[model samples]
Target: MSREHWEPVTVFTGGLKPLPPEGQMTGMYKVRRDTPVFCDIEGLRGDAQGDRRVHGGPDKAVHLYPADHYTRLAELMPMASNLLLPGVLGENLSVSGLVESDVCIGDVFALGDARLQVSQPRRPCWKISHRLGVDAASRLVADNGLTGWYFRVLHPGDIPPDGALELVERPSPGMTLARLWALEQSHRPSVEEVNTLAEAIGLATQWAQRLKNRADWLARNV
Candidate 1:
């Protein structure tokens, strides 16, 4: 596909405050504005991730969610439709055009002056449901494979809110985000499938290791 087919970033967001507590869970959920944000190997310079154990790392420097998905989600879960706006999902970049099916692991893109590579498909967590006040939202994301993807910064630089993201390179033996999500959701992926996923280029090291571990365990069990 042509680079012009790629989506343009609609909003860039970051938050200095923490997400308000609903029961015992709290985090930085409200990301605000289309400001100039600095993207380093770690993540957005000013952005704060409340739960460091599950977020904000070199491999997941930026979280991107497709703008189109929001409408579908709103229709699916009308109870929390008001909360389905940009940045509500704790994503740093909201873009149009590219969704999970279109993006592949190891695909590199140029966002303004910064270079980033697709790292992994986001594994939805309870935080999503907590944020939306809809207990089934996270499960729906996982089941539907509508969860967005993350990116690892290759070259740090300034990225404006309206910056256009263009594809730079795509690795061979393409593994699309949707495919990965399906593999993850499988009841029991074959050992060979796990091994293949672990060996895929452009996948984050952590995910590779997780797949490798699963393969090893499956081999031993079988």
Candidate 2:
């Protein structure tokens, strides 16, 4: 039991494919699954990312973009409304009743038999622009803090089709993904705040290091 009660709206998985005219590969075109999917330390079985260097890893194993975000996304980019849907952004799990501001960085949840920890907020990239066919798609998500969060598996198991995520622990209640993204977007965020956020429990190593670097730069330059 926790902040929001949410059942898995859908689970998605897909392999790499040419993005567009340029033929750049991307795995953002995930398809919804009606059957149970195996959750491993690496990720859901059959899930693949075009870019291993930045996309898939132990720290970024599973991605969840709240289904609630699509409405807001559509409001911001009406032209791309047709493309706004759960799993379209490459998320593995789609659920309602939860958004960025509702969960913290170190929150742990149990979905079916698997346990997952919030590792980092998903970073919006140009892929969103390509996926949505809107040049400002990525910027809109980033600027509005609509970017969802990622989950790193702690216990691998089968996630049933109708499974729900139940919050089991919250180690960094003050470090919500929304707050982290806001601080990162701030032109002159406090160095102390940045440093503290960099050390937030359960945050991804890459995200923590990036925050630390930002903190240092802010300390020296601002």
Write down the TM-score of every candidate.
0.91, 0.96
lDDT of 2 by residue, 1-222 (tens): 444448855789998899975778998888888888999999999899989888988999999999999999999999988888888899999999999998999899888889999999998998889888899999999999999988999999998776888899999878999999999899899999999899999999988999999988888895
For candidate 1, the lDDT comes to 0.81
Error of 2 at 132 (Å): 1.0
Best by TM-score: 2
Candidate 1's residue-wise lDDT over 1-222, tens digit each? 556535557644555454345444333465555677788998877777777788878898888889889998998889999888877888888887778888888989898779999999888888788778788999998888889988999999988777888887888345788888888999888998888878888999999999999899899998
Score each candidate by Cα lDDT: 0.81, 0.89
The candidate scoring highest on lDDT is 2
> Model 1, which residues run further than 4 Å from truth?
1-7, 16-28
Error of 1 at 155 (Å): 0.2
Flag clash pairs in model 2.
none
